[model samples]
Target: MKKWQLQDIRIRDPFFLKENGEYYLYGTTDVNTWEGNGEGFDCYRSKDLKLFQGPYPVFRAPQNFWADRNFWAPEVWKYRGRYYMIASFKAEGRCRGVQVLISDDPRGPFVPVTDGPVTPTDWECLDGTLCFEDDGVYMVFCHEWIQTGDGCICAAKMSGDLTKLTGEPEVLFHASEAEWPVIHREFDSEGFVTDGPFLFRDENSRLHMIWSSYGEKGYAVGISHAQKGVIGKWNHERNTVLEKEGGHGMIFEGPEGRTLLVVHTPNTWLKERVKLYSVEKLILGG
Candidate 1:
């Protein structure tokens, strides 16, 4: 068996699931994702986070799939005894949008649950993540700034079957809204770039979010908290949660019950690597 290494995968927007003492990783796989020709998503399983096995082709593009390429960030979650995936994709002349897929297992042959992308058809969106609340399941995603001068994060309620959007998206926050989100060299004449929004609940029963933005130091992760446990009123933390060349993070508890943050490090396409960090409980003091 070939020793599992990160080099084997040219992946971006990585997500993980810990199941039955094994870690299953799924991500956008393509030779060059920046040019956006990703075929589909794949899965890798590892007992120790290192030494992965199987580049199992979990999903293949459907014949009439609206998005032909740029398949990104396939995140799977166990909901109602089934597996659900929220992934980002792009079509020939359309902006990148997040879509939902369903499967029977973590390492799955996932199929689209909805007709097409769940994000607003008129707006550019990406990095959609599933967040459950008292009302129902919500699709929290980034409204790409590439199309708009200012990038924003928004959330919308999904229908009971999780097959379609139920209401208008509520703007949670904006890239310019965060004190820590910064723009490096102007890309496309716009000064802001926003990506990846993952929802996590800390030990204190507080709702928190971790998202990515570019800065002088390269891609970085910023943390924000919902004071009232609602999506619309997120308050950005003054300090970044993780500033070392990494972003697009997701939180999961390991077998030992330790919260771990998984993200791609060295942000650039040429040097990206899957990195994990043990999350420490942050105590806020006046």
Candidate 2:
């Protein structure tokens, strides 16, 4: 059997799930994520979160799928006694968008639940995550600044069956709206690239979101809180949560009932590695 090490896996947009006494890690596993056409998403399973097993082929691209490359950020969750995945994909000319996938198991050959991407057909977006609030399901995703030069995170309500969008997506915030998010490339012309947006509510009922962006220092994680418990009314925090060239983080519980944060560190294609951090109890000030 092949041994598992953090360096061995070339992944982006790392996500974690604790189920049945085990930790399952999922992400974009294309060997050539930065260039060239790529393969489908894969996952790894571990107990201690240090050693992983299998580059398990959970979801494989169909023969003539519309989005043949740039398959990224596959986040799975258990809902209604079934497994659902919100993942990003790209095609020949269309911009990246999130689509839903369904599976009977966590380690799945997740099949598409949507006819096509869920984000607006005219908008460029990526890194979609499912958020349940006020008895409704919402798909929160990032509108690629690559196209607009001002990336923004937005959310749209999903239909009951999770097969389609229920309403128009609402603009939550822009990459430039956050005090910590900055533009990295001065040459490319696009102001900033806002990547992943993961949502979670803390024990005190404070809704927080962690998203990725390149700042004055480097690529880092910026956090924001929802002042009124509404998804779109988030106010930016002055300080970033994790600022050491790491991002695309999501919070999950460990087997020991501890909250943990999973994100890819060194945020560059050549130096990225999956890292886990213990979530400390902290209070959010309004």
Candidate 3:
């Protein structure tokens, strides 16, 4: 068996799924993740976080695929007994957008399910993840700062089958909205960046979101508590969750019910690697 170490893998926007005693990992898997043509998403299976097995190919692009490059942030969710993927793609002249794919198995050859990108065709969007809210399912994604000059985390209601968006997206907050000291000049003409929005519910059903932004140090993670509900106002923690090179993050339960935050480090173009840190304290209470 070929064993793998977290530092040795070049994956971004890492997402972990805990099944019946097995951990399934998914993320951006293109050989050249930063640019050029994209192949598709892949999966890694493991009983423990360390020594992952297999770069199991999950979804490969079909012929005449709309987007050929910039495949990023592939997040998988088990919905209605079907595995669905929400990832970003970009073509030559078209703006980056999030699209949906479906498969019968978690580690599968997923095929495009949606007619096209669920996000606005002209809007620059990415890092879309599935959000199951009080009323319905929603897509939480980032509107790139490059396009709006002030990146934002937005949420939109999804159809029951998760095929399309049923409502207009509402901005939950901006990159500079967090209550932390930012070292980088993100609020200036350079623009603030908002990436990776994942929702986690505490014991009390209180909702908290983990997202990425550049801070006083560098690529950082921020946690926000939803004041109302899933789509409601969110209050940011005063300090960054991880004020290091690791930014884009998602939480998953590891062995012995240990909460782990999986994120990519260095924030580089293609040299990024996923790292995990214990986050049990964050999920103790609701």
- What's the lDDT for candidate 1? 0.81
Give the per-residue lDDT of model 2 (tens digit) for 80-182. 9888999988887887778899999889999998668888877878999988888689888988887778888888889977888888888898888888877
Which of 1 and 3 is ahead in TM-score?
3
TM-score (all chains, Cα) for each model: 0.93, 0.93, 0.93
Scored against the true structure, residue 164 in model 1 reaches a CA lDDT of 82
Cα lDDT of model 3 by residue, 30-85, tens digit = 87875678988888988877878878989888998899998998988889988898
Superposed by TM-score, candidate 1 places the C-alpha of residue 100 at a distance from the truth, in angstroms, of: 0.7
Per-residue accuracy of model 1 over 42-95 as CA lDDT, tens digit each:
789888776788888889888888887777888998889888988988888887
Q: How far is candidate 2 from the true structure (C-alpha RMSD, Å)?
A: 2.1
Reference-based TM-score, model 2: 0.93
Model 1 scores worst on lDDT over the 10 consecutive residues at 277-286
Each model's lDDT comes to: 0.81, 0.81, 0.84
